[model samples]
Target: MGERRSTSQSLVSWTRLRPYAMISPAILVFCLFFIYPIGYMVYLSFHDWNFVSPTKEFIGTANFTYLLSNLEFREVIVNSFIYTFFTVFLTIGISLLLALWLNRGGAIYSFLQASIFSPHITSLVSVSMLWMWIMDADYGLLNWALNLIGIESIPWLTSPDYALTSLIMVAVWKGIGFNTLVFIAGLQSIPKDLYEAAELDHTPPWRRFLRITVPMLSPTLFFLTIIGIINSFQVFETINLMTEGGPINSTNTFVYYIYQYGFQFFKIGYASAAGVILLVILSVLTVIYFKVLSKKVHYR
Candidate 1:
């Protein structure tokens, strides 16, 4: 009886430990890859080190102070905010429109959906290169088209006035398909019976949409808004491949600024400090997002 009781106790203990044992590998991997890198970056942010340096020199918050005082970094911050604002809102707005139009089941709708989403699945390198050709001021497709209509060629990626706008356009085009697909899913999940009831009361189309559709899609909107902000803030490939933050740093954003410092300039500590700033900005945005937007998200 004593042996049987001991065996039962061991079985209960094993059952209790099973879940943690199953999840231990994932937790370990997360710590190694995610937590460790972030911690190291934080540590590096406080010291001065070029990539080729044999040893790091303690610099305290000089990196952060320089970034704060630097005019170029301020412009980079402005550019990031501008790019993020335009990209996120345009992607969400246009995609919501497209989702509404294409939500029905039909072969033509399916084909159109696939066509729109094709750009999203394409590599960013390819997209950047293709857009470079298209937006080239001389002998480019955009210029050619404009010339045919008697409009002079406008420098899309070259002029400071239009360079950031051009990047925002690329971001929106690439992101819209995914946002639209998600919105469509959200729309489908909403109860059709509610719509039927509204229709029975002879509700206006606009009223039905405002009263039913918008509330039902609140959750999707909130999700896409947060994701869009984060992705737009981290934009790098398009700027790197297309503009290289050129035309006098007109297109220089946060991620590219960090890259320019870390890899191109070999200012590892400076870049790390910039990275920490980015992390803090994102964390604050996320917290504000939850605080301000959570109440508005309808979860039904």
Candidate 2:
């Protein structure tokens, strides 16, 4: 009997390990591609060395110190925060509304879901081009529409005043789909019984949503919020292609700044420092958000 018990335990251990074994390749791939690059970037952050330089000098904290003192860097950091805040909030909130609508269960549900999600799969460069055309003052569809409505043409891509808003609009349009899908999943995950219970208690729709839906969806909301913030901070492609950080760097995001510093200006060491700062900031914010908000999430 003891021998049989020992054999059973061994089998259970193997069963658990087998699944992990299957994923070992994936684990190795991530470590190689993701972790290794990030680790190397961190190591590179401290040095006053570009790969092109004859000798790489380890400057300790000088690169970081220099970056911190740059006014442009500070402005870019503030822009990162502002963009992240607005993008995340707007994306998640609008997505929740659309998700609620899509969760109502009908032909309209499927249609709206498909339509909204279609843009997500579209090419980013193409979307940027399309928005650029739409925002053009003289020959653009938007301006034509505005003229029809007797509204003044707004300088979307050209003017510093409207550049950031145009970018935000594009981002919101692109991001709403994925967040909506997440919300849809979260909404559907709630047990029908809970809503029935709420109904039994004569819970108003708004109260039920606030009390039941909000709590249960907290985990999904929290996850989307983090992801949205991360993506917003890393925004580069649209801004780079559309504005080119023009009109006084009004739309200069952190990642774009990194690209300009490293590739454009060949200040690889300085850019590495900027990247390290962003990594530290993101890591801290993610930890704080999860700590404060995670416990409040109701899986029900």
Candidate 3:
């Protein structure tokens, strides 16, 4: 009897430990790839070293200090904020409207959804190249269309005034499909009974939407806002391929600035410092968003 009890205890112990053992490989990979690289980046932020340098010199905040004082870096930071603001605001707003318009489950709606989402899944390089041709000042489809409407050709990608706007438009076009899908899911999840009751009570359509749709979709909106802000701050591919941060550096954002410093100029430490600053800024923004906006989110 005592031997049997000991074997049962061992079996129970193994059962309790098995799940952790199963997940150990995933945990190891996460630490090795994600956590280690972040830690290394932070460590490198304090030292001055070119990629080809033999030894790194301890700069101890000099990189951060220089960036803070530099006008170009300051402009990059401001541009990042501007780009993120417009992209997130416009993407979420437009996506919500699209979701509302096509919330019905049907073949037509599905086809439209797929059509919108195709641009998102399409390669960024391909999309950028396509837009470059479309936005060409001379002999481009867009200019040709404008001429049909008796409007003169506008320099979409060449002028400083229009370059950032063009970038924002591309980002919005790419992001709207995903946001729309998320909103559609949120909208569909809402109970039909609420709308029926509102209708029975003679509630107007706009009021019903305001009271029912917006409140219920708050959680979805909150989630999309956070994600959009993060993505917009990391705007690199479009800027790199389309404008190359040209037209008086009007579209030069934080990530592009980092690439220029690290890869182009070989100021590894400065770039790392910029990276660390970006991480800190994102962290703070996320925290603030949760603290201030999360209370308004309706989980159900």
Q: Count clashes in each candidate, considering only residues at least 3 apart in sequence or on different chains.
A: 0, 0, 0
- Candidate 3 displacement at residue 209 in angstroms: 1.2
lDDT of 1 by residue, 1-300 (tens): 999999999999999999999999999999999999999999999999998879999999999999999999999999999999989998999999999999999999999998888999999999999999999989689889999999999999999999988888889989988998999899999998999999999999999999999999999999999998999899999999999998899999999999999999999999999999999999999999999999998886
lDDT of 2 at 272: 88
Q: Supply the global lDDT for candidate 1.
A: 0.94
How close to the true structure is residue 213 of candidate 3, measured as C-alpha lDDT? 97
Q: What is candidate 2's lDDT per residue for 160-243, written digit by digit as tens?
A: 788888888899999999999989999998989989999999999999999889998998988898888888889988988899
- Residue 227 lDDT, candidate 3, scale 0-100: 91
TM-scores of the candidates in the order shown: 0.97, 0.89, 0.94
Where model 3 places Cα greater than 4 Å from the true spot, the runs are: 1-16
Pairs that collide in candidate 2 are: none
Q: Model 3, range 87-131, lDDT digits (tens) per residue?
A: 999999999999999999789999999998888898899989998
Give each model's whole-structure lDDT.
Answer: 0.94, 0.88, 0.93
Instruction: State which candidate has the highest TM-score.
Output: 1
TM-score of 1: 0.97
**Which lDDT value does model 2 have at 164?**
87
